[model samples]
Target: MITTFPIVALFILLGLAIPVGLVMALVGMAGLHSIGGWDMVSGIVQSTPLSTAGSYELLTLPMFLLMAEFVLISGVADDLFRAGAAWTGRVRGGLGMATALAGAGFGAICGTSTAAAATLSATTLPAMIKQGYRPDVAAGVVAISGTLSMLIPPSVALIIYGLIAEVNIGKLLVAGIVPAMIVTFTIIATIYVLVLRDPSVAPAGPAVPWAEKFRLLKVTGPVLLLFAFVTGTIYSGIATPTEASALGALAGFGLALSSGKLNLGTFRKALVRATYGTCMIMLIILGATIFGYYFALTQITQDLIIWVQGLGISPWIVMVMIVAFYLVLGCFMDQTAILILTVPVIVPLVVALGFDPIWFGVVMIVTAEVGLLTPPVGLNCFVVSRYSGIPLSEVFKGVLPHILAHLLALALIVGIPEITLWLPSHMN
Candidate 1:
């Protein structure tokens, strides 16, 4: 029987003001000592960080971050948003749709929600508002849409979940392709429907000259080429994700140079930010590694799985319960923090119930994405609010409609695991 003391210790420490990584490591150290003695405790603590630091699959994390930083500093996203605006400009709610589409594209490459929200908000919201998109709709769409990155491949969340769950990261990355498309379209449709419901939310924009629309692609060419190459290589089985990320980083650097955004100062800034991002993520991994070992020592997951199995409920019921738990957890915690703390417990239960980890990763992420638009701690909302100069309440109010769309997308994936599994199943 797992004692309440360890679990209590975990919660109590988490509730305190300590950094998340430190809290996990501290509880893990205490748990390790009790279950396996000083030698085992010290041995695991000493070894986990080394193995985590040395991980080969882990190389992709930093490389992807570098790629995003390069793209950000180079203004690649500016062209993307521009093209999206031109193409969708004349349609009702089209600017918002363009923002959503550009958000998906950015998220696919960057995989960081706060950065995406801030960057895309700055890029798109001002124009959307000037174009007569309601202040709420303009900021809300960018804020919520930016979270699409958390769902799409090259995603940090999926990578972490794959690592913790011991699933194939490549397949996990690949699995997100179809579901992302589904979500992207849903987001667009949600925007369109809201505008349809109340035309004041977003007015129809004047048509772009076809010539001008195509002309905008001039600035967008390098980014389009890079995006195609990077995503294509991964989907085509031509490169491991890490290798593709390296290529993408190179492509981003080249684009940065071509765009006139490259400089010693800019390069250094991107590199430093990537380093900081990589270190923070690595710490979380190490902490989770220690915490996973601690949970194993206490048999918490194993015992919980057995007890839940004894209930004789349907597997899908348990899966829904897990999703609900994540939804609740997400409201109060950072997505990364939730991943480190819950994946160990949740993955085992999910596997024991015969669910695919990759599919569950998609579901987990979509649920978490909803949290990013929700209240009390919606980081993305705050990022958008700060950048757009909108109140947080207005931003949240705007995101509510799209949040429904996100929930619909979640239901679609949950109802059809094939949505997430089909692409991965065919991966070369």
Candidate 2:
């Protein structure tokens, strides 16, 4: 029944094209009836909102989201990306590479893939396109690079997964560091390769003087400081992730205000957008909780595990299969929705195989991050195309290399557990 519940719900969700949050609720409602009585369903409905909302840690979601909204609204991301581009534009494929690096830096505090996509596309894509970069390359770089927001610290997806899976949010946040860097650098390298092969795709911009580079560095310092505060405070045990997020949000707001960029209008818009985003996220969590409750009562997950173990297949094979499943599912579902829908089942299977919950969380996020660039429903790609006036087809073509780079990073994290584990362990 647990298995059938999700399968049936998947069809129901797609059939009606319902909002993800509602679909999760519907699935949960149906699964509950199959596993338990209406009383159980009632209990879930009553408990889930309070459970999801009561988390002090969740305070970070709105704070950090508001922070990013302010940055985008106030045009701070534009300044940072401009500074970065000015410094990096002299080299082969430099503008495109700068986009990825800037995205990473922005992701350090922003943590929202769509914000990164919209801001970076608005900030960098037009510049690169105007400067003679290939449309697909520009669009693809923005699309895939925006996904850095998911892999970096303070990622909303990671935080949500950690909360639901009962993993330590700090550990999940720490674990994301190496994987994020690996993906970011690999993307830059991919850009270099592409430009090197077809020089026409990226004509190098004129170099900025060292003094000007220093000037650009001055503009970028605040973002760097905010990034350090968010991650450093958490790793140093000086503050919880929630506290760090609050700090980051305040810092982002101050930075924008200090720059004379954020005003009454931007503040209002940021709050409204943050509230809407927070509501969407909370609703999804509530829905997943109900759905997961029903799935648990059915014991289908347990039965499937036993049946799979009966096959005498190694646990590693099962692990690989699950990762493969996420990659495929990513082609359709958004990362947050996928996490809410799958982690209840997947995390348990991963734990059964002796994988660290934190490590698996990182792996899950990275897999889902790839979905941000996957075709058809790839949100980041569409966002970039929208902002850059590039054809979606071109953005799809451009994202191919970055997609391969992400796949490689995913394989490494899967094969070597230490990469994700080292930081969290050392900090402890």
Each prediction's whole-model lDDT (CA): 0.85, 0.84
Off by over 4 Å in 1: none
Per-residue CA lDDT of model 1 for 1-428, tens digit only, reads 24566668877877775677888887888778777789988899878888988988889888888988888887767778889989998888889988988888787678788999989888999989998888988888898889988877678888888878888888888887788888889889988788878998898888888899889878656756776666778878899878888898888788678778789999999999999999988888888898889888778889899999999999998888888888888787888888888889988888899998888988888898988888887889999999888998999998888887888788889988988898888878
Top model by TM-score, which number? 1
Instruction: Give residue 420's lDDT in candidate 2 (0 to 100).
Output: 91
Number of colliding residue pairs in each model: 0, 1
Which residue pairs in candidate 2 have backbone atoms (N, alpha carbon, C) closer than 3 angstroms, thus clashing?
Answer: 28-291
- Model 2 vs. true fold: TM: 0.96
- What alpha-carbon RMSD in Å does predicted model 2 have with respect to the real structure? 1.6
